[model samples]
Target: MKRTAALVALAAVPVLFLGVFFVLPVSGMVGLGLVSDGRFAPGEALEVLGRARVHRVLWFTVWAAALATAITLLLGIPAAYVLHRLDFPGRTVLRAAFMVPFVLPTVVVGIAFKHLFAGALAGLALDGTPVPIIAAMVFFNLAVVVRTVGTSWESLDPRPAEAAAALGAGGWRVFRTITLPALRTSIVSAATVVFLFCSTAFGIVLILGGLRYATIETEIYLLTTAHFDLPAAAALCLLQLFVVTLLLYAAHRARAAAPVPVERRAPGARRIRRTDLPAVLAAGVALVLIAFPVLDLVTGSLRHDGNWSLANYRALDQVGQGSLVEASVIEALVNSLRTAFDATWLALLIGGLVSVIVTRRSHSPTERRVRAGLDGFFMLPLGVSAVTLGFGFLITLDEPPVNFRDSPMLVPIAQALVALPLVVRTLAPVLAGIDDRQRQAAASLGASPLRTVLTIDLAVITRPLLAASGFAFAISLGEFGATSFLSRVDHPTLPVLIFRLLGTPGSHNYGMALAAAVVLAATTAAVMLLVERLRVPGVGGF
Candidate 1:
């Protein structure tokens, strides 16, 4: 009875948190959009949905995401394969650190890409076009393909390929017949996630694509904020919700289709071989490609108009005070850190409780299915656009039972919502793998259920939980999508401040933006490195 009560209590926390903060706001936002004046009107929703601009935005979102996914796979697959087969110094370290780009704020990345390609694309003025936007998507999302597929590729049985080669099969033929089949499920899962991210993209689309490009996410933001067309934003949110649901469902099915476990051994970075030089060089090249934009951003911040100077860093003080954002550099940094601290605690508390409820003692098929359903539920926030959620906050939080419209907790609440899914993803896998036999053994030894959980399950997840905390902190520091909508002038996070600075004219404003982006990048990188260093040996990554 005590154990049952504990389980119920554990489930209630996440259930209540998500229901009140997430589901209620979104549902209320939709109702506000569907209703005309005081009455529910289907005609208003239909009219918004039937607009020609809506069709155009939907089409662009689909095709651009498809292009980005295809491009990412084409390059990411080769990189994953090379990293898997090669044994060299720093290989394991590289794999663990690959999340640097994935964890970066999209607004910061958008700024980096603009500088990286500004000269190259000057002839065509590609800022408002799809090319730069899709490229940015690839830059940010390639890590997904590499991590998921590489995790699978590293564990593939090599004997089958060796046997095939011995029987006169060529390398390509061996790969086609043996290696490719083993990686299909993971590859599909990675591709679907990449596609979903690119489709629901907000920061890059807005900053890079500008007004010329319109994805459903960007359109939703523009419709509500720029146009005050709540009904239109609501319609797009519905369509977005449906599309994201399908993608999440597809990703879940792909992950579920894997019949065998991947990464059976700890990642190994053995000595480099004579034959491994080519793959090693390729890996080095790949790393450089990924690392250059960041390096350039740092350099660009310090070098102003060809003369290296501290002028840009000095300008940081002038950028905020009594200026556009109204907060000093120190104030913004303090606010960001304070909010991130609160957000990380919230994510750890809520996600930890949910994971406790999700971790099962039995490995039955029904239990597995239920676990997967729970996984999908937790991850839905990630798949759903942050813009949609932000708009939901605008419409729902101004009145009634919990009128926190101007409350100080709003920023951290938004940050926590954004970080919760990642926390769950980070912690759930480790928790679910805990053998029920451990609990059973403890029970047989006369330990109570509560004691069994404390000593067994909780003890095991300690390191991974730390990793989750790092992720939550990093997310809170770098998040821009929802923060763009929710943050007020008085309290701006780094990414939000950076976006505003970049939007303003003048070289001073531009330099300050780069300087701020550098700070945000450094902050996120430090958090992720800590995570990599402290992570549990065999746990999955962000």
Candidate 2:
């Protein structure tokens, strides 16, 4: 009964957050699309659905996402296997390297990818286009497999595959029958995540695509902010939302059907002698693919005008100074930092509160239901397209008792929404793992619930909370979809600045964008290193 009450209380936060910001706003946008003036009218939606341009864009979105997901799985599954199954020198470093892309801001990724695909990169013929854009998205999303499925794959017993080998099963046969089945759930989970990412990709598409292609996200941005077509944007966003929800449903089903005995194992294994060479080679290639864009950005940043110079770095503070209250580029960096910080705080507070409440009384019926509902609500933000949410906020925030049209709070608010799911997912596992005996012992010794929690639960959860908050901060820093719309013109975030730099013509502009990307990449690397530092010496930090 006590636990039930806590869950019910915990349920309130996500429910209210999602209802107002997610459900209501999204529903309103969809309704706005289907209604004409004050009544129901599906004509605009029909027209949008029937257009060849719309179909082409939708097809591009689906196929590009599919291609990206496919490539991620190909690269990720092998890397996950190696990471999960082998013990080697620099294993820790390799693991950390895999997470670099996820921590980096997407805007930084866009700039880096653009530079890597530059016409003169590494004496290779390069041009920023759809191929490079898709390649970058796949690289960025590979970490999803490493973190989600790789963790699970590491837990799987090697005995199953060994047993198959002992029975004269060939390598491919054993993998097809035994190893594959064991990983099916995780593969689905990771694939869905990759798909979701590619579908709503904003920064990469914006920079590398260069107006040649448009995903639903790009289309929505063009429709609303550029063309001022609210109904069309709403309709496009609703389509994206519906598709994403379907994918989320599929992910939920896969997760539920996964075997319940999922276990964690220490990362240790003797090298598979015959397979070691291939594994190492594969890992090398994957690392190069993942690391090249970053390297390109860094190298490109330092050298411009046929020689190495700090001119780009020096110019960062000067750009957009006269046009805005603050130097727009530097202001964007400051805005991104501030928003990331605020988003981290908000995510930690709300996510922590919800995690505690949900796990308080797991044995009670009310608590179970409430916890489930809250979990669903928390995950809603993950499934909802950030582009769709931005459009919704654009339309909704203008009207109502709280008109935040010109508010600086809007950027962080949207960023917090984007970071919420990552924070909750990261923290919930740690909270659930807290030993009940410690709390019980404290209570028996006459400690109050608050005191017991402070001394016991807080002690256990500190590292995870920090790591999770770091992830939240990283996501918010890199997030571009919503921030682009919500951020004030004068207070543009780093990504917004990067996008502007890329859009403008000139080698100087491009070089400066690359330099900023290098800075952003450094920030991402620092966050991951922090997360690595926080790992508890036993359980791997996801």
Candidate 3:
């Protein structure tokens, strides 16, 4: 009974936070579309789904996400094997380099791909086509596959494969029969996450595809903002919510079905062999694919009017020509920093409570089930469309009893919710790994529960806590889709400002956009680099 009381106390803050910020807003948005004249009426919304344009958007979203997931797996598996299973010089640096893209802002990625296609691959004419959009998706999601699969690959026992090899079984035969089966669970989880990200992608599609090529995410934005079609947008939101819920459920089942290992083994990375050439080559290709757009973005920012200059960087202090924006890039950057600072603390507080609530050793079946439900509940933000969240905030939080239209912290609160899932993921595994006997021993020694947690949990979770903070900070810095709807014109985040610069005409505006993207990318990369240095296990994996 005491333990139940403690669990309830621990879960209260996170529950309230999500209830007010996540569930309420999403429910309000869904209600807006389904309810009419104080009565439930989904007929008009359902009719919108029958339109030909909606079919095209739905078809394109599914096919594109499927294709991107396939390519990511094909490229990521070899790279994951090479990076995690082989010992090589500069391997750590290379791993960190690959991870930078995953943390980069989606808007920055969209701009980088735009620069790459227009500048380096101009002759190929890939710009304004689905090719760049698909490539961008691959580039952004490859790290997820690498980290998720690589973590699992790193810990697998080598004895089984070695025994098979000793029996005259070739390497391919061993991998096909033994290694692949062992990796199936992690591969499936990674693919599901990558597919979820690709399907709900907004900034990349909006920037590269425009109206010519639209996905469900961008279409939702267009319907809400341009078409003023709330019912249609809300209908699409329901569709998105349903799909994401299904994906989350599938991932949960896959994880639950995975067999727990009877024995644990230390990582057994070996020196490269003759047979590793294919994997090495694939890793090299993956590196090139990651580096090209970043290189183009940097080079494009440095050049202006067919000549190299720092003029673009110099213009960061000014709004673009003809007052393209209300705030300068530098000012927007300061706003981003301040907002991220607020968001990091909020995410850490809520996520820390959530981690503790879910990781505590449950003494009863009912308690364990409740904890499991809460864990899945917090992860809804991960799969839900960010645009939907942002749009929902606008409609739901603007009226009496919950008015936040003029609140400065509204954007940070939304960003915090988006980062909460990552923070919980980062910290929960670390907390769960702790030996419960240590806590029991501490309690037997007459230490109170608070003292036990402070001495044991705090000691173990400090580095992970810091790491989660950095993740939240970096994600908030690059957040765009939600910020787009919630950020005011006078206090725009850097990403919002960069997007504005891209939309405005003039060479200077374009140049500034590139420069601003470089700044945002560098900031996020630096944070990720520091997080990597902490060497926390399962920091960024799914």
Candidate 4:
């Protein structure tokens, strides 16, 4: 009974936080579609599903996400093996470089691809096609595959493969029969996550696809903002929610199917051999794909009127021509930093509590089930559309009782919700890995529960806690979909400001957008680099 009471106490703040910030806002948005004249009417929203344009959006979202997921796996599996299983010079730097794209703002990635096609790869003529969209999705999600599979690969026992080779099985035969089976779970988990991110991608599709290609995410934004069609937006949101929920559940089931445990061995990263040429070549291609757009974005920012100059960067201190933005690029950057700082702490607090609640050794079957349910509940932000969350906030929280339309903390709170899942994912594994006997020992020594946690759990999770903070900070810095709806004109985040600048006409505006994107990308990359240095397991993995 005491243990159950303690579990309730531990879960109370996080549950309340998620209920108010996440559940309430999403439910309110769905209500807007179903409730009319105080009557529950879902038919009007469902009618949106029959629209021709909606069909096109859904089709494109599915095929594009599928294609991107396939390409990411193809490139990522070889690279993951080369980078994590083969010791090579500059591997750490290369690993960090590969991770930068995942943390980059979607708006920045969209703009970089545009510049890449227009300036450097103009002859390809793939500027406004679905090709770039798919490519960008691969570039953005490749890191997920690498991180997830590579983490598993690093810890995989080599004896099975070595034994297979000893019996005269060829390298290809051994890998196909031995290595692939071991990696099946992580591969599936990564693929599901990549598909989720691709299908729900907003800023990339919005900036690159424009009117030519529309994913469900961008379509929802257009329906809400441009068309003022809340019902249509709500319909798309429901569709997306259904699809994502199914995908996440499938991933969960795949991961839960326990693999036969092997006797553990230290990572045996061998020196590169002649046989590793193919993987090395693949990794080279992956690096080029990651580097091209970033290099193009940097060079594009330095050019003005066909001459290389710092004019675009200098213009950041001033608003664009014709008052395109209410705040200067520099001011917007300040807003982003301040918002991210606030968001980091909020995510860490709630996510830390959630990690503890879900990871604690449950004494009863009911307690275990409750903890499992809470674990999945906090991850809803990972699968739900960020734009829906932000839009919901505006419509639901503006009135009395929960008025936050004018609060400075509103944007930070929304970003925190977007980042909370990452925090929980990063910290929960570290917490769960702790031996319960340590806590029992502390308690037997007459330590209070709080003191037991402080001395035992905190000691183990401190590094992971710091890593989670940096990871959350980076995610909050790059969050755009929700920030678009909630950020005020006078206090826009950098991503919002860059999107606004892109919409405005003028070479100067375009140049400044590139420069600002570089700044945003650099900030997030620096944070991620620090997170990586901590060597926290599952820092960027699922």
Where in model 2 is the C-alpha error above 4 Å?
1-14, 121-129, 258-267, 320-328, 362-364, 536-542
Pairs that clash in candidate 2: 105-478
Off by over 4 Å in 3: 258-264, 539-542
**Candidate 3, poorest ten consecutive residues by summed lDDT:** 258-267
TM-score of each: 0.92, 0.93, 0.97, 0.97
RMSD of 4: 1.5
Q: Please, what are the lDDT tens digits per residue for candidate 2 over residues 11-31?
A: 677677667777877877988
Task: State the lDDT of candidate 4 residue by residue for 95-153, as single tens digits.
Answer: 98888899999999999998998789999888889988998999999899989888888
Return the clash pairs for model 3, or none: none
**For model 3, what is the C-alpha lDDT against the true structure?**
0.90
Model 2 lDDT-worst window of ten: 320-329
Please give the ranking of all candidate structures by lDDT, highest first, separated by commas.
3, 4, 1, 2
Best by lDDT: 3
Give the TM-score (vs. native) of candidate 1.
Answer: 0.92
Writing each residue's lDDT as its tens digit, candidate 3 over 384-452 gives: 778999989988999888898899999999999889889988898898999999999999999998999
lDDT per prediction? 0.79, 0.78, 0.90, 0.88
lDDT of 4 at 65: 98
Task: Give the worst 10-residue stretch by lDDT in candidate 1.
Answer: 261-270
Winner on TM-score between 1 and 2 is: 2
Better of 1 and 4 by TM-score: 4
